[model samples]
Target: MGAMAAAYGPLLPYLMRRFAIGVSVAGLVFGVHFAGGLLGVTASMLSLGRLTSRVAVSGALGLMAIGCIGVALALSWLVMLAGVFLIGIGFGALDLRINQMLAYSVNPKRVALLNGLNGVFGIGAVAAPILVSIAGARYGLIYAGGAAVAAVALLGFRGVPGRLRGASSSGTAPSSRRTARLVVIFATAFGLYVGVEIGVAGWMPTHLHSAGFGLAAAATLTSGFWLALAAGRFLVAPLTLRVSDSAIVLGGTAVAVLCLAGALIAPFAPVAYIATGLAIAPVFPTGVAWLATLNPANPGATSWLFPASMVGGALIPSAIGLVIARVGAGWVPTILAAVAIGTLAAFAAAARS
Candidate 1:
C-alpha cells in the first residue's frame, strides 16, 4: 500500500494533467504496474533455485527504487508507464520475499501479529497522499519524487539480512507442483481481497463526493476505511489464538459482505464509508495468515502467494476503473460489494480444499 500511495498519491493529479488522462486511464496506468507485478512473480518463481531470498528481495527493492526515480524524471507518458512497470516488478519481488521470510522465520505464536504489522503498508498508504501533497505543494513534484525513491532504497537495504535468513532455512522442500498450486489458490483469494480493499479505498472519495460529501468529509471517510482495516488486523491477533482461523475468516467475510451491502444502501455518506471500512478490515491480513499456514517447511512459498495476491490487488482496482468508465463511478461501492462476496467464496473454497 505504501508503494501504491507513493506510486499514485500525488502523481495521480499530475499524471492526469501531463497525460491528459481520465480516471479510467489513470486506473489503466495502475494496471500497467500490476502487469509488471505479474511478470515479477513469474520471474521470482523461475529464479527460485538460482537466487537466495535476500538477493531476490534486494533486487526487487532496487527495481522499485529505480522505478521511483524513473517516475520522478519521466518527461513523457511512455516513460511514466515504463517507470510504473518497473515499480510493479520491484513491489512484487519485495512482497514475495518478505512474506516468505515472515512465514518461515517467525514463530507460529507470533505470526498473526507479524501479519497485522504488515498493515504498516496501509499506514504508508495513508501517509503518502498527505506527504506528497505537502511536499509537492511546498517543494514541487521533483522533491516529492526524490523522497519516494529514497524511501525504497533505504527500506530495501534494511530488509536484506532477514531475507537471506529466510531463504537459507534447512527445511525439506514441499513438492514443487503442490506448492505452486497452493500458491495459485492462495494468491487468487488474496488477489480478490486486495482488489476489493484497494477498489473501495481508491474510489471512495469520488463515491462519497457524488453522494454530496464535501472534500474534507470525503477524505475523512476514505481514511476511516484504511484506519479500520489497519486496526482490524491488529485487533484480530489475540482473537485468532482463541478461535480457529477458518472461523475467524468466515465470520469476517460475512460481516464484510453485510457491511458492503449496507454501504451500498446507506443514505448518508459517512455511514456508508464507515461501513465499507469496517467490512474490509480483516480480509487482507487474515488472508495472509491463512496462506502462511500452507507450508511449514517452505516459507518461500508465501513469497509466491504474496506477489500473486498483489497482482490481484493491482488488477481488481483497474477492473473497477474499467467498470466506472463503462458504467459510472457512483457504482463503485456496489462493485466492491461483489468483490467482497467473491472473496468470501474463495475463502470458503480454500477452506474446503
Candidate 2:
C-alpha cells in the first residue's frame, strides 16, 4: 500500500500539472499501473511452475524498488507512466508471491488474522497523502517526496525472509477444475471491489477539495477512509467468528452503498466526506477473509484475489477520470456510487458460490 499510495498520491497531482491532464488521464495512469500488475500476475502464474516462490517474490520486490526509483526520477509524463507500470508489475508479483507464501506457510485458523495484518497497507494509504502534501509543500514536486519513499522501500527490502525465496519449487500436481473455477470467481469479485475502493480512495482528496474543502481538510477525509478501512479489517476476524462471512460481507456492501450515496448526493460537505470513509471501511480485509474461507488449502487464493481486485482498482478510477473530464468532477462520486453497486453485486455472487 505504501508503495502504491506513495507512487500514485503525489504522482496524481504531479501528472495533472505536468501533462495538463484531466482526472480521466490520471485514472488512465492508474489503469496502466494495474495493467502492469495484470502482466505480473500472468507472469507469476506461468512461472510458478518453474520458479521457487522466493525467487519470484524477490524478483518482484526488486522490480518494485526499481520502479519506485524510476517514478521518483522520471523527467517526463511518458517516463512517469512507464515507471508506474513497472511499479504495478513489481507490486503484482510481490503481492501474488507473498500471498502464496501466507496461504501455504501457516495454519488455516490464522489465515484471517494474517490477512487482517495486511491491512497495514491501509495505514500506509492514510499516510501517503500527508507525506506527499507536506513534502510537496516544501521541496517542490520532483525533488523530495517520492524520492524519499523510494529510498525507504529499497531499505525495507532487506527485511524480507530468505525462506520465502524459492519455496514454489515444490511444484504443482493436478488440482480440481472446480477449484480453478472458484479461484476465477473470487478473483473477479476481488477485481471489482478493488477497483471501486482504490478508485474512490485514490481520487477522493481531489474530489473533496474540488467540492470545496481545503487540502488539509480533504487529506483528513482521505485518512478517515483508510483508517476506517484498516479498523474494519482488524475487526473482521472477531466479527467473522461471530457472524457468517456472507452476512458481514453483504451488510458491509449495503452500508458501503449508502455511505457512497451519501457522499455523492448529500448537500453538506462534512456529512458527505465523512460518509465516504464510513462506507469504505469494510472492503479490503473483509473481501480477503471471504475468499480465504472459500479455499482453506491455499492462502494464495487471497493473494490472487487481491491483485485481481487491484486490476479493478486501477481500471475503475481511470473510468471515473474519463467521466470527470467529460461530465465534471461532481460526477465522480456518482460513478463511485455505481461502482459500489457493482461491488455489492460481486459480493452477492461470491455469497452464492
> lDDT of all predictions, in order shown?
0.66, 0.65
Q: Residue 232, candidate 2: how far off, in angstroms?
A: 1.9
Q: For residues 1-353, write the lDDT of model 1, one tens digit per residue.
A: 36354336234555677678787787766678778887887677566656776677778867776776777677778888887788888777666655555555557655576546666766665655455445442323543454476565656564455333334434324458877776666667777887776677677766776677654456555666666666666767777778777777777877877777776653764566566565566566666666667666565566556565667767888888778888886787788888878888888877887
How does each model score on TM-score? 0.83, 0.84
TM-score of predicted model 1?
0.83
For model 2, the stretches where C-alpha displacement exceeds 4 angstroms are 6-11, 137-177, 266-279, 298-307
Candidate 1 accuracy as lDDT: 0.66
Position 193, candidate 2: lDDT: 71
Residue 65 error for model 2, in Å?
1.6
Tens-digit lDDT track for model 2 on 1-353? 44365336445665677678765666677787888888887677666657666567767767766666776677777887787888788777766766665544555545466446656766776676666666553323433344465456555655554443223444432246765766777677677777767766777776777788776666666666666666666766566567776787678777877777677653564465455554555555556656656665544455467557667867777777777777777776777778778878877877776
